[model samples]
Target: MISRILCTAFVLCACISTTILCINFKEQQWYYVISTVFSNVSNNDYIDIDLKTAHISRNVYGISGFIDVKRDIPDDAITIEIQMSRSVSGSNNYVVLPFKYKENILYCWLNNMYRDILMPSFGNCSNALQLGNREFKGPLVKKKFEFNKCLVNVDTLPKYLIPAIYKIEFKSNGLAKIYVQLIVRVYNKVF
Candidate 1:
C-alpha cells in the first residue's frame, strides 16, 4: 500500500513540474560575432588567413567575411581574391579585382539561408563564388549588397568558407583586420 502511494505521489509531482515549466517556454533568435585579427600587417604583405580553433564554430549555420583596413589605404587600392582549391580538378586559382573600389564593404554568405539580403559574388552574377570550392574576396564594412545563394558545401573544404587569405597588397603602411562573423540563432525556452 505504501509503495503504491509513493508511486502515485511521484507521478503527480512530475506532471506538475512539467506543466509549470511549459508555462514559461519562449523562443528567440540571435547572433554572436567572432573576429580574427591580423595586427600590423606590413605594406604589400600576403597575410595568409589563419583561423584558430576557437575562432571557428562547427555549429555555425551562416557566416559573413570582411576586412577592415586603416583609412589611409586608397579607395582605389585593389583587394585581390585568391581561391586556394582543395578539389582534385581545381587546386589553386585566384582573380585580381577591385572589390573595395566597387563597394566599400564586401561579404559572402550561402544561398537558401539569407541570400537575397547579402552581398553578391565578386565577378559575374551568373558565376557566384563558392565557399568550399575555393573562391574568395576582400575588404568591407556594413552595406547593402546582393548575397549569393551558395549551393556549395563549405565543410568539404575549410578554406572555401573564409573570404580572404590570398593576399592584401597594402598601398600604404597600415594594419588590416580580417573578420568572419558567424551567424547563429538561439532560442530561449520559457517553460
Candidate 2:
C-alpha cells in the first residue's frame, strides 16, 4: 500500500510539473526578423557580388571577395572578421556542423560569433571610415565544417589605424555561395 501510494504521488507531481512547464513555455519568442539591404559598391573588395548567382553548389562550397575602397590602398589600415551560422546540407537540414572562424574568435572573447547575424572587425577603424573582410589583413578564411545558408557581417573596424584594403575568402565543406541583396551600406571615405 505504501509503495503504491508513493508511486501515485510521484506520477501526480510529474504531471503537475509538466503542466506548469507547458504553461510557462507558451510565452513569447526570443528572436525577431528584420528588413534587409545588400547594395554593392563599385570596388575590388567585391569579387562576386551578386544576389542572382550566390549559391551553394552540389559538390563544393565557399566565398571570397576584394574590399574595394574605390582607389589605391594599404595594409594595416583596417581590420576585418566574419561569423557564420550553422550550415545544413541539402540531404539533411538538421544534421549540420555550422560555420566558424577561429582566428578572430581568439585573442579576446570566449563566446562564438555564430548565433545572431552580426558584423565583426579586427583593428582600429572609424565608425564612419569603412574597412572590410581581410581588407586590413587579407587572410584566407578556411572552413571548419559543412552546412548551407549563413548570414555574414563585414565591419569597418575601430577607427584608430590607417585606412587600407582587404579581401575575404570564405571556403566551406559544401557548395554554398554568397549573395548580395543590396550594398550592405555605403562608406563616406572613398579611396
Candidate 3:
C-alpha cells in the first residue's frame, strides 16, 4: 500500500512538471512581425506627413518620418482615434477588432498613457517627439515634428495576440487631419 502511494505521488509530480514545461514552451514560441506601415495626410493645408522610411527588416519594423505642422494647434484641439481590424482569410475585407481608443492628443501626452497603443509603437508622445527635436506638451507649434528609426517593441504588446494578420488605423481630427495604417502578422516562432 505504501509503494502504491509513492508511485501515485511520483506520477502526480511528473504530470505537474510536464504541464509547467509546456506552458513555458508555449509562451516562448510566440512573437510579433510587422508586415507593412503606411501613413496618409488629408487636408494638407494644415499639416503634411512625410514617411521617409517605413520598412520591415529581419521581422522587425521601423519608421522614420516627420509631420510638418503649418499652423499652431492649441491644447485639446487635436483628437485621435485608433481602430484595429483583423484580415479575413481569402478575402479582401477585414473584420474590425473590438478595441478602439479615442482621446485628445494633449491629454494622452500629459498623462503619459497608452504607450503601448500609440503610433510608431512609441511609449509616449513626448519621448517620441523628443527624438525629432520636438515636443508634444502644451501647444503644438508650427514646425516639422519627427520620429526617427522608431521600432515596435514586442515586449510592450499585449500578452496574447491571435496569430493572424492585423491592421491598425489611426485618425487625427479637430485642428488637423491625419491618417496612419499598419499591417502586421503575429506568428509562432520556430525553435
Candidate 4:
C-alpha cells in the first residue's frame, strides 16, 4: 500500500510540473524581428548594411555578409530562425551558422553551417542549434534560408555582445554568381 501511494504521488507531481511548464511556454511573447536593407555591389553581390559593417568585395567568393541582432533575446525564447536569400537561379549550395558572444569577442557558437555540408548522418552543430535536419537549395530564384527552432541556452547567453554576427558561406560550384539578404525571427512556442 505504501509503494502504491508513493508511485501515485510521484506521477501526480510529474503531471503538475509538466502542466506548469506548458502554461509558461504558451505565455511567451514575440520579441523582435530583424530584417536588413541590401545594396547591390554588382550583378551577384548584395549586402545588408543595417546589420553589419563589413565590405563585401568581389561577388565570386566571400563572407557574403553578417546579420546583427538589434536587441538581446529573452531568456526563455524557445526558437530562433535566420532566413537567407540569394541572387542566382537554377540550383547550388549554401550554409548559415550561428555565433555566440562571450566575454568581449565572438566565436562560432554552433556549426549548423556544416549540417547541410556534412553528410546527413554526421552533424556537429550544437544540439540547441540543430533542432532537426536542415536543408538548402541553390539559385537566387528562391530567396530565403531559415534556421528553425534553435535551442539556445538562455542562462549562459541571455545577451550577446552588441551586434551579433551570423556568418553565411556560399558555394556556387564556380558556375554561378550570387548575392545575399537576411532576416532573423524569434518565437516562443506553445508546445
Candidate 5:
C-alpha cells in the first residue's frame, strides 16, 4: 500500500509539472507591438487637434495631446464609428476585421456603453481627459481638452489573433469631423 501511494503521488506531480510548462510555453508564444498612429481633422471650423505626443515607446504606444473645441457640441450632434482591419502580408491590401462599433449620440454612448464596458478593456477614459479638466462623460463643451499619456490595454485582445499587421480607424462626425488611425503588429515571440 505504501509503494502504491508513493507511485500515485509521483504521477500526479509529473502531470502537474507538465501542465504548468505547457501553459507557460503557450503564453510566451505571442506578443504585440504598436507601430504608428495617424490623425486627420476634416473640418477645423469646430475643432482642432494636436496629436504630436502620440507615439510608440518601448514597443508600447500612448496618446498625449490637446483638442481645442471651438464651439459647444450638443449631445445629439455627435456620432462615432470604429472599424478595424488586418493587413495582408507582403501586400498593401487590407481585409476588414469583424469588429465595428457605431453610435449615433456620443454623450449617451460614452456615458453608458463606453463607460461601463469598453473603458475597462481599453484604457481609463476619465484619466485621459482629466489633465484638461474634463470628464469622460460629456456634451463636449468648448475648451482645450488634453490627454495625458493614455495607453491602450492590448492584453484584452483575443489570443487567437494570428501574426499580422492590424489597423484601427476611429471616426467622429457632427460638430466637427475627425478621423484617427492606429497601426499595430502582432507576431509570435522568438524562443
Candidate 6:
C-alpha cells in the first residue's frame, strides 16, 4: 500500500514539474566579416581570400571539404554570377552581389564567419588580370574589380550541411562585403 502511494505521488510531482518547467529551446547563430590584409588592392599588392571552420551544433559541430566554384565571366564583361558546385555547397546564408562591401560594424544575433581562402580547383579567379585585373591599365584594360569568398549563418539551420564551394568576383573594387539571412527552427516532443 505504501509503495503504491509513493509511486502515485512521484508521478504527480513529475507531471507538475514538467508543466512548470517547459523548455523553449533557443536557436544558435553566428556571423563574421573579413577584410583584405592589403590596404589598397593593386597589381603589386592583391586582396586575399581565406576560409575558416564553422559548425551548427551547440557543441562539437564543424565542417570541412573540397570547395569548387564557377563564375560566369560573360562575353561582354559587364556582369558575372558566382555559383557553387553541387559537391562544394553550404547551409544557411549565402552571398549576393548587392551586399558585397561592409566591414566595420558587426550585426548582432547573427555573426558572419569566414575562414582562410583555400584555392580549391581554380585559384584562377584570384590570379586572372581582369580577376587578375591589371592594376595599371594597359591598352585592353578597362576597369578595376574585386570578389568575395564567403558563407552566412542563417536563422533557420540546415537539415544537413555538406561540402560547399562558393565563388566571389565582382566588377568593382568597391565590392567588399556580402550579406546573408538565416532562419532556424526547433521542435520538441513531449510525450
Model 5 agreement with the true structure over 151-176: per-residue lDDT tens digits = 65544555456789988887898767
lDDT of the candidates, in the order given: 0.31, 0.31, 0.68, 0.31, 0.70, 0.30
State how far residue 189 of model 5 sits from its true place (Å).
Answer: 4.7
Best by lDDT: 5
For candidate 5, report its TM-score. 0.69
lDDT of 2 by residue, 81-148 (tens): 33333212312122212333543322121122322222232112112122333222322233122212
The estimated TM-scores of all candidates read 0.22, 0.22, 0.72, 0.26, 0.69, 0.19
Candidate 1 lDDT score relative to the true structure: 0.31
Which regions of candidate 5 deviate over 4 angstroms? 1-30, 52-57, 116-127, 130-138, 189-191
Model 2 C-alpha lDDT versus the unseen true structure = 0.31
**Which ranges of candidate 6 are over 4 A from the true structure?**
1-5, 16-155, 158-191
- Candidate 4 regions exceeding 4 Å error are 15-32, 37-41, 44-176
Q: Residue 96, candidate 6: how far off, in angstroms? A: 30
Is 1 or 5 the stronger prediction by TM-score? 5
> Clashing pairs in model 4?
84-145, 88-140, 92-138, 128-151
For residues 1-191, write the lDDT of model 4, one tens digit per residue: 99999999999999999998776655433232333334232222221222222233332111223322223322222122234332222133323334322211011112343333322222221111232543322212222222222222232332222233223322111212223343323333324
Q: Candidate 1 residues 13-121, lDDT tens each?
A: 9999999656533222222222222323343142323212132345332222222232333323433222221112222344443422221222332222214322233
Assess the local accuracy of residue 38 in candidate 2 as a C-alpha lDDT between 0 and 100: 40
Q: Write the per-residue lDDT of candidate 3 for residues 1-191, one digit (tens) a residue.
A: 99999999999999999998788655545676666678887677778887634554665666677778788778788778889998748255789988787655754643443433444365443234432323346576778767666765555456567677888887888766788887777776655
TM-score, model 6 to reference: 0.19
Model 1 CA RMSD to the hidden true structure, in angstroms: 16.3
Pairs that collide in candidate 5 are: none
